[model samples]
Target: MGKIIIYEHANFRGVSREITSDISNLGRLDFNDIISSVKVIGQPWVAYEHINYSGRLMVLEEGEHNYVGRSMNDTISSLQMITEDLHNPQITLYEHPNYQGKSRVIREATNLAAGFDNDIMSSHKVQRGAWLLCEHSDGSGIQYIAREKDNLPHYSAIYLNDKLSFLRPLRPGQQLCPGGIALSSPQPCSWHPGCHPAPRGRNSNSRSPAEMGRIILYEHTNFQGLSKEFTSDIANLRDADWNDLASSAKVIGQPWVLYEHSNYGGRFLVLEEGDHSFFGTKLNNKISSLQMITEDLSNPEITLYEHANYQGKSRVVREATNLAAGHDNDIMTSHKVQRGVWLLCEHSDGSGIQYLARERENLPNYKAINFNDKLSFLRPLRAGRSY
Candidate 1:
């Protein structure tokens, strides 16, 4: 069994209470509307907004959460432990309500692919384990959690109808029991002092570097000056005292996008796995937010427009090509990145100045970045391709 330590104040301070079993209502312990921080050991746990596991929910993974996020802080009224094996989780999504219409069985994390991608799902059925559905491909925006269920007839009841774009199973934590009451052999707990002994099993921090994803930002160019390493998304670097301070960076596993404004707004740059000594003139000391791309990049697509604002002639490009060979050289002034990241180069051999564009709506004017009428070679960036 797992354990949860709820705190009365942020950063795990003040009065604390340890729980090793399900609690339908915190009011019974006089802890309702007062939990501010928490630390989880062993299996992952779920916190609910109302008693009896009803209303809003947040999954608490292993490790300490100094603050339980704005939406869940001081609002959790119920707790439930996830004891089922999630190693091979699975779920089936339906195109219409009551399990009707087309259906797709999902067994792994994915940014919904073509045909069924976007807001097309109206219902679902979780055959095993727990799954998380997100409103955006990058796992941002609204979200919903679904556990083992034979049928979820409608999404309207959960306010997630036609809004899901990403899906991933919530993997079980270490030392989870088969059901919910069978305790595994006891082991010394190293996370907290005076806490209950932990169960012996895989360490929660044993995931591979690729799964964790890391990026180090440096204040000065050439990997000099102040620096900080991050393993998760930062909607606003200002909160970490690092806004507009990164002149160079190093991506260890997955690619990351740096935004010019907070909350993932404005122009952006995608940095693939490798060392970056400089950010160039466009983004030097100007980054304000960061987001990691966790989707597969095997298939890429983009549309180029002959004139600005998606007007005039256009062509879809899926692979690296010399535009001159197709009589489309030096003519593209705008483009829409339908999928994956792309590199637009000024020369046919992919030399000279280049621009990185990610999935987004039409970029109406290349002139804004001094690239108008200069396109010659273009290609989608793939994994293991150094930037």
Candidate 2:
């Protein structure tokens, strides 16, 4: 919590009020647009010119102000505290995606064109005001508006992987896309931002050839633990000491088609370029064979069934968080998606282990993706306004 002392006079004289919480309308308290001076203690705050935090905006840091400044003087009507480390205005940068590996914090607006050029920087979390990130050193290439508390998982999909080189804070009057979350990281501008940099290996391989084509499978979520890459079709995962042990995957180049049995038999599914956390039941640790397929870019869609092999009750979905409130744990088997991508979960609200479904057909058994008649939820690719 924080406290703000608003004075009706410019030099802290006359009627005054101290606020420690959100006030949508100050008029009710007889302090509407009378603010002339201010003093803030603890967290930062944003004061709006009109009621309900609308109209002009003002960012007040933790300090004493004899006057409210030219832009916000006597125009403040409503205010809300922004929870952050007020002592310092900085952003944390992670070396690897998903807030992994080494890390560093940037306090002032800086450029990474020299020593740090096109290196590290996989994920980030803003601790202050809005930040403008650019791919080029001089602020050219790709640009993204990062607001406070933004958590970027990965930059691969946005063509920003190891591509960010500059950053600066966004000034007043500027605005960002609004809907759900207030922050977003280097997400792709569109579905097709050209072929992304060759697949990057999390552990085993450090290879990214010009024409590289490989898919890496992780034994754990968040791309941790042991991992292996595949470039050609494998008749059996056991042949390489890796059978029924794939929990996550990162695709590159062409798409990969997986199977539940050796010799490309049993239940089969396709996967494009991206990262997957949960592989689900039968396919989780039961993958037996896989073959690469040509890349395809199109809208994704999926259908869920009450029984395996496209049987019984079924539902089609094209977006995220398809609630299975009444039908929780009522899914089994499947016919798979014909276009785009999706993640099948064992719990409702798209939580728990997520099973990837990409152009797969006839999953007579839910054993491959895990749970049998226990599917609770699903979500389409690219969450919110951006991926």
Candidate 3:
């Protein structure tokens, strides 16, 4: 459960109201367009600009918000607690209304690529968690909040048709249940010792959960030609007679990194859990090693270098930060991942072209990936505890 306290005046002054559940219309309580500040507790909540949870939206993570910001100040008309498990958000975007035409599934926060950007999305289906769709690559401009839905046939009804450019899951506050488990209802039995049932004989028809971190590499694009499946790290693909042979891949459960050289050296690319039809020009048939990320990601650390090959000034980061606010903006040409996985972004708000960096990796050159001197924001990926 979650709680939200709304204030009628800035800085917690004036009248206030405490909300513990969804309110479709603030007018009923005579609180419409009067809230100036807010404080959230236990979980995340969303404030909407219109009644019935419609119009523009703002996500309120657990913390005190002295002011509701310019866009949402004194304009909130509705509120709803976010009760979904945001650890592995997923959504599908349709190119045409009524769930027609081309579609793409996304499981991570992303700045839409060339073909997917520029007012191309017309409908969507949220398979897991809530998502924020924005009009700019940096997550600014007009926005729409989308929650889990079997089908949202028309974006035009909301005046957002073919107008989305960036999207991301709503991150919850860093509150863990006992033993570091994320609070999801109906907890898995594996998380509680002595609750497991007796082991049963293996069944070929049984499917393994995505958390198993399985990946399949293909020798050709679109999963054609020779292929191999991996469930663990491969220091050198050459030893398996598959060096420089991966043109495409599919990931299940956790994310994986593909390195350009043996022993996990050189440039790398992070692939999230999904089907990858192509590995792009720079990485196609160039993967020499792979690393499966299976460690805790709650605490991530990375060091950015001003110059390539780990030279020049450097900055050590342990949490999400905007480099522009410091002296490291647009100057990081190399980086070393000390722990957990991190997302490097080109904008101050964790948007724009993004790159995934994994733990125990020393990437000495950003030029090879065409991202030299362009980093502005970064944050660790919070995938929750493995069950």
Candidate 4:
């Protein structure tokens, strides 16, 4: 009896015990070589290396796929730990760079260059690169990217010579690249684009989240792509989402907002003025309902008043004959006068807000209008009707 060795990437499983016919032709074959040979052998089973979909590689295995040589499980661990469970454990070998530390998020070698190409040449932050099995599910995302240096993509990607290693949805018994080739960085299994690492970069800590143009919040945000900003739940998580995150922000999670921003430790003009969150954090200029608005109200500043129904400003100016009258009349009035009526109306009404008459006479002519209403209305003296 002799020992058996199985190089699945090739169609050879029991080379020693079953391969007494082909030793003369075979010399040396690496993982890539093995996978390529299987494709040429025209066998029932084969290995695929090129990426299939957006970026995935597939590995296939048949029944009792490989019952040959004694295989080692942990290639990185020098212990040469072997697992012969015979259960036919499915294993995909990994090839990564030497360095096992954090590296700059942005690089030409990164896969993001395809769609996540912000194209930043260099920065101050310090980081490194390497490869890993991405084994533990807990090790999902690119973690703790320095203060501002976190927003980046972290999927089953590898960057080499500025090229991204796209996969074809790997499967069982598939051949894997030699070293650890990564899209970039050491991210938590949760790391993704536009999610937790949206704003993080090499110059992270020194800059503000606003400066980074994005924000990544929470332990792991489940997303992909580089949006304008980054924040937790910015995309409004919904059903039907993508499984991985990387170079480009994906709408798989829902709403597909790809980017977001938080108040950071201070206040900013996100939605509007006065509207603020804890720590005086204000909304930026997202401008939807006036509710999210918290703007800087300067003294005697021109501000826009909004109604639950209306969009733009909800108020205007009007004048009265008495000159120093209070609010304007809540009447559908024209820009003219009947009896000593000029400069009327200075406030708003329920139906419509006041507007400057453009006619210039100041006094307005009452048209379609009633008195008090829900939103409340201030009526000035009528043409002939007193007060």
Q: Superposing every Cα of model 4 onto the true structure, what RMSD results? A: 20.7
Stretches of model 3 off by over 4 angstroms after superposition: 113-118, 173-387
Q: Which 10-residue window of candidate 1 scores lowest in summed lDDT?
A: 176-185
The lDDT ranking, best first, is 1, 3, 2, 4
Q: After superposition, how far is residue 366 of candidate 3 from its true place, in Å?
A: 23
What TM-score would candidate 2 get against the native?
0.29
1 or 2: which has the higher TM-score? Answer: 1
Model 3 residue 244 lDDT score:
78
What is the clash tally of candidate 1?
0
Error of 4 at 85 (Å): 25
lDDT of 2 at 167: 68
Candidate 2 wrongly placed segments (more than 4 Å): 86-105, 109-148, 151-387
Local distance difference test, per candidate? 0.81, 0.67, 0.81, 0.23
Ranking by TM-score: 1, 3, 2, 4
Q: What RMSD value applies to candidate 2?
A: 19.9
Name the candidate, 3 or 4, with the larger TM-score value: 3
Residue-pair clashes per candidate: 0, 17, 2, 87
Model 4 agreement with the true structure over 1-387: per-residue lDDT tens digits: 011133433344322222211121122222221321111111112122222111222222223433221222111110000112212222121122332233333221122222222222111222222121221123222211111222224222322222222211112221111221122223322333322212245853364433312232121223222222332332221111111222222111111122122222221112211111221111222211100101111211111123222232334424222212334223223333212212123343212333221222322223332212212233222221111
